[model samples]
Target: MIAGVGLCAAAAAATPDSANAVVNIYRAELADGSVRFASQRLDPGYVLYLPGERVAATSDRTRAGTSAAQAVLEPDVLRLAHRHGVDSVLVLAVIEVESRFRAQALSPKGAFGPMQLMPDTARRYGIAERAGPVQNIDAGIRYLKDLLARHEGNEALALASYNAGSGAVLRHGQRIPPYRETLLYVAAVLARAQVIRNLGQP
Candidate 1:
């Protein structure tokens, strides 16, 4: 059976939002019937202790013009993005990639709402209802602003941190981690943001 002895101890000493601070944790069963934990998969012996959230697959729906749902939410996105000092188009891009404007969308990892925020992240940002559009977008833009600040306003690094957590970025020498999902996520959001910029906002 799997054990979380080390994981529990680590969690106990970590900040409440530590799960969102790191990307993944690996666990390896040693030859001595013991376990070792690491931030990355150092070798074949290690498996993901905490798996990262799967990036939502991209599709035409994500690239299409504003939908009825998106239109309904644009006002809040604009207002909150401005309030948080984030680009409205970038916020829209993230929403498009994350949930296609579906406020009720829920990921397999339990990230919910248009922003697809994990529960801990939502609570950390004082979001009582992850499915509420205004609250979700507000919290999301705020979080993005914080990430941008953490990375010194490097949009790519901020987006990468948003996808894979800041610890992953730091462990990789302040660069985007090599995880395929995170790479695609950063590219997708930036690409979508550019497209929105060209299209002159929804």
Candidate 2:
């Protein structure tokens, strides 16, 4: 059964069931590690909840034929975002707009690794120094969480910071700044996020 090999490949990469994902959020420390005190597997929009904001995500490579990428990443991201009180729906939208789910994609602006951080920003976020998918994802998650915190939980402002940096957002007085790319980026992320949030694919 030569066809069976293809099936096995697909099955191996199949996304975990949202209802069955082992989801948890932990408080991580650079020195002492971290632990999860609260956890759950069920939350509406745990698959995608579009918070009203925009940010440029990478291309859609991640969501390509691989098929299972969203299923795998969405639930994990949602759980972590929920832990930090971040809206998973909005985050998924941003990811869709930004990376198109392309994990290994690189941006022209010197953003590297997944989540597409500029080399300098990646270093600051503790990614450039590390070499692994988990490290890259952790760095992105932590940085996004920090942005959410800085903007008083306003997803739009936080997304602006993610696009243009915190200094720019602060200079603009906690508003989504006027940078055209960032502005359009935010709008697209918000819209697509809404799409996936409503889709709620397993």
Candidate 3:
């Protein structure tokens, strides 16, 4: 099980109305094809993606652990990144730095999932289910694609926007913010991406 009981409680406390209540706990498939429970406070502007047709049955979670799951996840993330017109290496780097491929990872700042998506960021991308690995990864990459477009294909500025808010980047004259966290995030992602590319993970 994922460590989400606490998150569910936090979300339930945040919204009292059943209609608008945040889902604190939910089940989603992990990269290893196992279902795990997760919890996070749902941000406004996101609604569930209820498919019209019934979906096929999901896979059981393999006990082979993180490495096996990551092996599955990397190619999936790379495919999604390509579909979104973003570099697969960049997405891989972000995943490494953000949550180290842990689909259920959550930050103290309330960023949740492998891509460490802030609540507002997830909402903006229409990610109804933040706990699911595939949904979360797709949402993050879609956001990254938009950021890249906004920054005229400049990876550094795009990464800065991803770390800090785009508003912050614009306020700083459309440059990477000087904040230490954002700067380090940009550098680390770039460096890691170079390493991945060097190893021919493309």
Instruction: Please report the candidate that would top lDDT against the real structure.
Output: 1
TM-score versus the correct structure, for each prediction? 0.67, 0.60, 0.66
In angstroms, give how far residue 63 of model 3 lies from its true place: 23
lDDT on C-alpha atoms for all candidate structures: 0.66, 0.49, 0.62
Off by over 4 Å in 1: 1-64, 129-131
The per-prediction tally of clashing pairs is 0, 18, 2
For candidate 1, write residues 33-126 as lDDT tens digits.
4344544566788786433433343443243456899879888898888877787878887887677788887765677788878788899999
Error of 3 at 12 (Å): 43
Candidate 3, clashing residue pairs? 8-24, 34-61
- Model 1, residue 70: C-alpha shift (Å): 0.4
1 against 3, candidate with superior TM-score: 1
Measured with C-alpha atoms, the lDDT of residue 71 in candidate 3 is 83
- Give the candidates in order of TM-score, highest first: 1, 3, 2
Per-residue lDDT over 104-179 for candidate 2, one digit per residue giving the tens place of the 0 to 100 score:
6455555544466667777887556334544555667778888878766666667667777888877877666665
Q: Candidate 2, 202: how far from true, in Å?
A: 7.6
The candidate scoring highest on TM-score is 1
Native-referenced Cα lDDT, model 2: 0.49
Per-residue lDDT of 1-202 in model 3, one digit per residue for the tens?
Answer: 1222223232322211221122223334445433323233234322221111222322442212236657869878978988988888889878866776888877767788888888888888888545598999999999999989987887877877888889999998887666655644555456555545444545
